[model samples]
Target: MTGGRTGWARVPAPVRDAGLVAVAVGDAWLAVSDSSWPEAGLAALACAALALRRYVPLVVVLLTVPATVVADLVVAPLAALFALAERRHDRRLLGACAVLMAAASAAPWPWHDPDSRDRTWTLIQFAYTLAGTAAPVLFGQLVQARRDLSRRLAEIEEAREHERALHAQAVLARERAQLAREMHDVVSHQVSLIAVQAGALQVGAKDTDAREAARTIRSLSVATLDELRNMVTLLRASGGRATELTPQPTLADIRKLVATSGIDAELTGVLPDTVSTPAQRAIYRTVQEALTNVRKHAPGAGATVELWCEGDDVGVTVTNGRPTRPSLPLPGSRQGLVGLRERAEILHGTFSCGPTPDGGYGVSVRIPAQPA
Candidate 1:
């Protein structure tokens, strides 16, 4: 039954109206008493009025009344009453239209004197016609009710989906807060101890190699602690509350980054003042990641960090020489380069990394002065 209704609804409105007009015209032709002009004209008018039923339903119903009384028409008037009932919410108005339609259907054409028997039979026919009019009006009201119910159900479902989304976000915020606490309480404490021990070893060790190794460990541990503190701050701020964030790195910080990188590196060149903050951050991260990779993979290699501007583009290039010693095996997710590429794409820029011709590694990134 639902499929049948869906198929019927897919029919074009004008086509449906044309079909109803055709049905009404056919009923009028079969029921009219004679080929007289008055009767035939009224029947034609009633059928034609069905075309306007959806827009002016009450007017259409009234237009059909003359044809009903004159030519004993049934389909045209009933169809008009159904249309009015479907669109109108006033019960009194619908009741009045239904009564008018029944009266028209039962009345005699060309009024004349009648006997008692004729009057009694007319009364019986009037009651039967009144009962028949009820069917179309009731059915139209039922269809209206079903339409409202369907809309209400859709609204209810949408509200439920929104509530589910909010609940999921709350759960995620709580989990982030818990993770932040664990990093601060346990992970941060452990890394702090490691940094302290490495510092002490660097101070006490007499062998040149041992002191250098301890110094390198201490430097790496301090960097790790700084990053962990930043992460914890961000995670704890995830619950829609405002908090001051740690200042982000920019182009001005590039020189300091190179100095602290613990590798022999040179910094040169200047970017334009027109470079956007995000673009600056991208360039800073590029140099930082490149230098870190050199320390890990190209041990004892010297690096060059160059910042340059050409036309409307500003960029950074970090290139390192081949390692002087074999690099120790280190666990890595290998996501650093992938992340740099994604960031460049977001800023409508370009990033490239590969081995240099001098048996060294190179990382370069160029971004627009004003990103889109």
Candidate 2:
């Protein structure tokens, strides 16, 4: 491409030179009548000016316009047209050159013969003509250059935005994988315990503690499943990674959950079974904590867990019937209910708690689930 451009640039030089020689010869013939200066000297200077028109156009104008004045003060002065084309940048110079050229063209008729002077001032016409000819071409070049620069800047900004987005996505993916890994480690280990206990109970049906442990394992497993589902939903909705979105058992799953808690309490679920895991986990956790509460608040009262996954969502109620007496120090995390609400909020779910009409503590959750 460079070589091709070089070749093209070379092609114009010879043509320009030939055109210059032609203009100088034509101007010289017209000027010879003036005989104001030696012909050889004038011709040499004119030839040089014409030849160098492309590069030193101002100089060409300086030399040639005065020469044209001598040669065609009345006929057809011409050097300023080339001047207008070459040095368009200096308006002041352009005006001066224009006035001189026009004066030269019209001068011969007046300076040589007053009766022949029709118009010794055609510079106004020439000036107007020059502006009209150059404005659009120069304006177009300027506009094109601006547009090209704007387009390149826009492209660069878009590339930067794309790179930033890709980088953010990569970071999110890495964090998601890390979260999933952590969840898998925690929940899978819990499930493994449940499965192993089930296997143990199945193998030794005669052991009471094993049976109880098996039941506990079942409760733990059910709760674990619900908690895992809730955890996943949270991970996903929060832009973490819920790619494996699945319905989590809500209050409806608590009966099975508590039945597996290894405690001697009746776990009931009056609510529908389509409970979402976040809700179910909330309820399960409530019962789990209530049981823990019972162990601390009233270890001797028999406990009953009733879950209602009905209406807008699920409700969990735990009553220990006055707990038989007061005690201290629960066997589990004391912040269970707080954690439950925290979990619910994480899922964009709602939670409520207080005493039920029957005097038992009631925990209610309204999440994304069909009523019973």
Candidate 3:
């Protein structure tokens, strides 16, 4: 990757090379400032050799070795050794550079003077040279290791992020499928009623306009049913049928539900003839589920169904008396109430079911006139 403006771009290879050249020139000038003509020439040659250190580091170090004997031109050898260690991990090259630096450091002292050529002084010079050479090599290896570790960590984080995104997509797909199935149930039930009413109109209507209207309603219902079937096909992978073609229960069907429940049940409500289809369906299902629960859990108890409309909202409450007989050990899927609650909430309605103050179970729902 290319460097960004405020980041790694600040230190390009050309700029780094230029800085190294400047350091080499400064060191050479210091060494030749008060030396003989031969020493000055050698210093200039050593500084020139430093220019090639980044390209052929070993060759440049070898070239600078001769000049160090005449003047202390350490920049070329030190820079070359650092570059070699950073770019190559060959132990032989490092050992060769260390030996060369030791010779150069000892060359600077006056060996002809017996006092200065003592064992202690020679050993000290060799130690200093070895330290200078070894420090740069160790630092370069550390930098390389750090870069490798950082790259590995970045790869791991990227993989984890990809996995998280895939999981979120899978969840979204599942939710959409569930919504489609629920929609098919509700829409199919309402459309079937429209088809039934249109059939009745076709049989009873006297005028031409009324008959035509009934025919049109039947056609529309059939077309809607076809579309709903197609939607279900696309949403589900393998389900028997998208929706039931048979008639579904509505508010008008509550009487039938109560009679078949077998429990002592009481239902009282005054739903408007023009109530919205969704509201009627919700009321019907809530009562039917409550009656079923009463039969399963309270075998012989009485239950009451109360429904009331206040302003723009309609409410239904189903309550049962304490069990009169022993409860049945019926196996329950346990998803009935949860699904009902989800259905109400999706339509911007409220549903709640729990134990009543009278030591019996109660289920209640309040729905808006128009869904949001």
Candidate 4:
């Protein structure tokens, strides 16, 4: 490409060069300031500007234009016509070129042509020279606009690609979360069953007093196994279709959750019919975590759970009766509520858990119905 461009540049436009020659010759070049230089020599000097016109259009106009104008009055140097035509689009060049032509034509000079109607010809020549020089500036402006538009288009494409990458990242994150939810549903149930069966085996190793404990273990095991099977079946299915995972538990699932805690409880509230699945899950986990804490910290105490929606908001509050005796172990992941509040805040929701004035502990979480 470099070689080809160099070759093209060297291959001069003969028509333009020839035009310079003709114009310079006819102008009868005279010394611009002195008005005495040999006509032929003056012509040679002005015509030289043509060769460098492409690289130095403004300069070429500036030099030849004044020289031709001054020479023209003594010689009416019209070679400036060529300079005007060559860079006619440039306003500054045209102005300089025009001044030269007027001077050259107006200066006293010998009129040689039989057709010389001096006044009329000089007037017409001046007008044409001015118009031609204005050309280069106009053309340059057009070229600049095209380049600006191209640059803007390239920037827009880059911005679009940036947005696309962000979108892809968001989709991938959502998919991973769905997979995690599926995994937990399956594993938690199996773990629960194992715990129950382990308890049963431990109890059955003893006497008649152990029968009641064994039966309790068996019941817990059966319930756990049932939950585990449903979770796994839904996950293994392909084609993005399923049936058994149908009604994943919601806040309403808290009744069974509290029952598992073995605590007497009351639940009341109206949950929104339309809520994002994540928000619903957050609520269930909150209640489940709070109740588990209650069972561990204040076991025989009663708990009151209330959940409902008001307009576009869903609220949940769980409070447990105070512990009369202080020796029970904490039943929940002790640090879990901190993580839970961080989760709620991400959706612009509120979460609070602490001891209330009545001596019991309470947890409250409110999420927007249409949370992001």
Task: Say which candidate scores most in TM-score.
Answer: 1
Query: Candidate 1's C-alpha lDDT?
Result: 0.80
Better of 1 and 3 by lDDT: 1
Angstrom error of the Cα, residue 95, model 4: value is 6.4
Q: Which ranking of candidates, highest lDDT first?
A: 1, 3, 4, 2
How well does model 2 score by local distance difference test? 0.54
- Model 4's alpha-carbon lDDT is 0.58
Q: Identify the leading candidate in terms of lDDT.
A: 1
Clash pairs detected, candidate 2 = 73-108, 74-108, 215-260, 219-260, 236-242, 248-276, 248-277, 250-280, 271-309
RMSD (Cα, Å) of model 1? 14.7
Q: What is the lDDT of residue 37 in candidate 4?
A: 59
**Candidate 1 weakest lDDT stretch, 10 residues:** 239-248
Tens digits of per-residue lDDT for model 3, 21-96: 7898898888778888877786777677667766887777777776676777667667767766766678787777
lDDT of each: 0.80, 0.54, 0.70, 0.58
TM-score against native, each model: 0.56, 0.40, 0.48, 0.50
Error of 4 at 277 (Å): 5.9
Stretches of candidate 4 off by over 4 Å are 1-57, 64-120, 166-248, 261-279, 292-302, 308-314, 321-350, 367-372
Q: Write the per-residue lDDT of candidate 1 for residues 1-372, one digit (tens) a residue.
A: 122358778899999999999999999998875668888999999999999998999999999988888877888988998999899899899988888888888887787887899889888998999988888899889988887777777888899999999988887886675566445434554565566557657878999999999989988987887788678777867743221123556788888878877779999998877788878877887887787677667877999999989888889999999999876444332445765775587688999999999999999998888966
The segments of candidate 1 whose C-alpha lies over 4 angstroms from its true place after superposition are 1-7, 33-35, 112-122, 202-215, 239-372
